[model samples]
Target: MMKLDICQSEVGTGLPSYSWDWWTENEANQFPQELEPSTWVKLSEVPSSFSFEEALLLCQCSPDSWLAWIPDHGEAVLHRSQFS
Candidate 1:
């Protein structure tokens, strides 16, 4: 399995952002050949140490980072951050 480091922007809930750096070609190359093309790696296909509830909390509370895998996406990471 491929490993990725997830990082969250320091910006708070007003506009929270998370980045999966491993999705890039340069970063993917650091891993096995299988991950050369990130499109082949679905977000849902990977395992994550976090839960839905935890993700929800992270969205609500930005400036937090989690080393988690990308979830399967139809087009792109569609998760949005919204403050209550």
Candidate 2:
């Protein structure tokens, strides 16, 4: 399959209160249910400390690392970074 690059926003110095709950709530508003696994690639072996900032940093700092979607006390979703 043809490859595609993904674009994700960086937390930067803002969003000190960013957390998994915040993400899920916002997503819930947009999507009543989680998108199918095929819609978005989920990463593997996501770290327990996974955060959007951490994933972004990992992609920026360690390009080989996956974009991890780890919510505290929830299942983790990881994805290969095509843009990393």
- Tens-digit lDDT track for model 2 on 5-74? 9878685756466544334555535642322322333233345443333333122123233333333433
* Model 2 weakest lDDT span, ten residues long: 54-63
For model 1 the TM-score comes to: 0.19
- lDDT tens per residue, model 1, 45-81: 2233332211111121123222232333112232222
Alpha carbon lDDT at 71, candidate 1: 34
The superposed Cα distance between candidate 1 and the true structure at residue 52, in angstroms, equals 8.2
Measured with C-alpha atoms, the lDDT of residue 73 in candidate 2 is: 30
